[model samples]
Target: MMVNDKSIVWILKIYLLIIFVFIFMPIITSVVFSFNSDRFPSLPLGHFTWNWYDKVYYDSETWDAIRTSIIVALSASVLATIIGFCTAYTDFRYSFRFKNAYLALALLPPTIPLIILALAMLAWFSKLGISGQIWALIIAHTVLGAPFAMAIIRLRLQQMDKDLESAAWNLGASEWATMRHVIIPFALPSIISALCLTMAVSFDEFAIAWFVSGLNKSVPVVILEILQGNVDPQINAIGSFVFATTMTLVVIAQLFLFTKKPNNH
Candidate 1:
């Protein structure tokens, strides 16, 4: 039995490694080709060159997309995190009818198909006369990102002691005061994690942005436009930059999540 278990463990490790490689190989290829002097990706990569990166740096359209993505990401992440915190705190501190239904709706956006969600957002924004605007993309991304923020913060809240808030109230602290001094402090790490995660989500999202962002394009939308034309080496460079950025944010979020210390309160 011990030998069998060891063999199984080894098999699982190999399987996991393969899965990671499969998922990341294309991204790795894109990064590698971004630095290759050759326009076409092939064996025996040409001499390393920074030309593609330089081109991406100077491309006005690319800069515009990057700036739009940054603005949308920042705005959406802040809005999403605020909404997520409120939803999570309500779930934690309140007991009301239809609570489960509320949670289901809160967490539903990510489960819906992106194309369907995009179409819905476009139509809704059009009705509101906000279609084809940067705000439209920002609003759409906020909706898409809020659920993720909620999930992360909710997990942190679940680990908190129920008596903590009660103890604060039993003292002289008002509801707002207790929340500010106790709950927010305890959940601060998770809040930061949620912000980073939601920003990453908004930064990488494409379909909805493409639908609602008629004139103001995000990075992913721009990538799609480039792809529609021809095989541009700039695509590889842009993809590499995006991959790096999202990965960095995700890594930071994970670190905060895992390294969060238990509140002494």
Candidate 2:
């Protein structure tokens, strides 16, 4: 028994170590390379400097792309979360024929080949005379983000106590009031989580963005263009900084919202 327990512990430790290293190795490598004094993104030994980050600061195209990316991500995330909430709430509260089919269709794009979806969107936008613009990208991203938001919020709603909302309705509250006061507050954490996740997905998304972004370049496209032209270490600097900043914000939000407080039970 003792030997088996020890063996299991060793396996678990090894598994965790492997996972951690696998996840962080690339990030560590990027950070190290970003500081290398060489203009080229390369390795072993070089004097470290902040010039790459400084270069990033002065790049107008990079800043423009960053601004564009933020706008697109925020718009897509908010729109998607709202639509998903409405869809999920309706599905949970009502019964109808083909309800499952509707959900399946909404979720199909995320699982399908990104290029195929992009092409379909491209065709649709061209038909609508709205091809190749930031609006197109926002539309595409919202469509993709909606499924995830729906899944997240639906899970939370499923676990929620329906009696709370029912009680409010029983006391002569309107449907809107019950939901606004009861359901929304109870589900706030999950809603925030879903919204944040959608934002992250839209912010970092590359393939679909590459397709639907049209003439207005987002950060990922701009980064790709810059790297393709020159083996610039500054690209590495920008990437490392973005990755670190994103992770930090995610961690802070999670801790702020999800941490359990003493005496809550």
* Strongest candidate by lDDT: 1
Task: Write down the worst ten-residue block by lDDT for model 2.
Answer: 255-264
Candidate 2 segments exceeding 4 Å error: 249-265
Model 1 earns a TM-score of: 0.96
Worst 10 residues of 1 by lDDT: 256-265
User: Candidate 1's residue-wise lDDT over 18-119, tens digit each?
Assistant: 999999999999999999999788989999999999999999999999999999999999999999999999999999999999999999999999999999
Give me the candidate number with maximum TM-score. 1
Model 2, span 16-89: residue lDDT tens: 99999999988888889888897665655589899888999999988988888889889998999898888778
Give me the displacement of residue 63 in model 1, in angstroms.
0.4
Error of 2 at 156 (Å): 0.9
| Residue pair clashes in candidate 2 | none
- Candidate lDDT scores, in order, read 0.95, 0.81
